[model samples]
Target: METTEKSVVRRFYDIVGSGRPEDLDEICSPGLVGHAGAGSNLAELKASIGSFLEPFPDLTADVRYLVQEDDLISSWVSFTATHEADFAGVPASGRRVKFAEWDLFRIRDGKIVEITQYCDLFTIMSQIGALPTAAPA
Candidate 1:
């Protein structure tokens, strides 16, 4: 059961890395609830994924760590991409960015029902030059 849960999350990263948003419908429950920003449900989740891919078509996610307990899977992932289009009100900067995020997935009946993600938006904005970075003292 634990392995199956982890595989679902692994497949999610695979789909995202390969830029196949359509596959999400199979693994995610229609009644999905997301604790992450703007991804409150399955449709919103798919839209947010599409929105992100529009700017970073080459985005890839590497699962740095993964753990499953009960029906919940926790993953720490690293993502790399190049800014190729406008995002978050910032014009394209043509810069490569790497960021790490922690995600929690709740699985039921082999489908992802709930998701929560924690990422540092400030760091990502600074990396893409959407926000000013301070020089080291």
Candidate 2:
């Protein structure tokens, strides 16, 4: 049997990279929430995502692992991007950064009902200079 997690992640990346935002509304429930600890709801999550990716217009996620249990699907992803605009209150640094993350999805009735995810915030902040860079010995 094909793993749902792998298929979900693959479709998600394809959609996010090239599909319209409206497509998500069709595949996801209107009451969908992305309460990923730091995020409280889908709206907040969307805004946070906007802030976090403000600098990386060309961001791309590379899938490494995909696992699922019952209705939940999880995937590990590595992303690469170059900072060119403000992100999460940090000015662009023109630095190329790569980071890893996990996206956990909740599926129901053949559609995504909810989603929660985690990412490497430190890598993003440091790359954008919001966090001080370590000094070389």
Candidate 3:
């Protein structure tokens, strides 16, 4: 009878937004799949996260809202960090970037079994200089 989806969401971010990469086992399922972005499975997801944040060791996620129902949690969050390592084939630039994202997670057996996430890469890429920005006329 502990309907605490918001608390679960906070706990997840406390580990992910603050803890080291090795903490994935504490939050994600063994075969978790992110359906909205790259990184096919849990292993891939962890590796990708580690590699992406490698350059920006100080990555931080600022949560704006959390919505939950049954065993599902949805979050609206903005993450900020400086690029100091390779990310998605883009070399490090040491540029500070901030981007907002939506993440939907399905929890089962007290762990996240599946995740569907969406984020704006164009904003991040532009902020990191991986993509050219349009100039105002």
- Cα lDDT tens digits for candidate 3, 36-70: 56267787767766666677688788989888888
lDDT of 1 by residue, 43-114 (tens): 887887888899989999989988989999999999999999998999998999999989999999999999
Give the better candidate number (1 or 2) by lDDT: 1
Highest TM-score: which candidate?
Answer: 1
As a whole number from 0 to 100, the lDDT of residue 100 in candidate 3 is 88
lDDT winner, 1 or 3: 1
On lDDT, the leading prediction is 1
lDDT string for model 2 (1-137, tens) is: 76654465577666554424445554566677776632656556555555555568777778888788898888788988888987777677898988888888888866677787888888878877788788778
Candidate 3: worst-modelled 10 consecutive residues by lDDT: 1-10
The lDDT ranking, best first, is 1, 3, 2
TM-score for model 1? 0.92
Candidate 3 residue runs with Cα over 4 Å from true position: 1-3, 135-137
RMSD of each: 2.0, 2.5, 2.6
TM-score of candidate 2 versus the correct structure, residues matched by position: 0.81
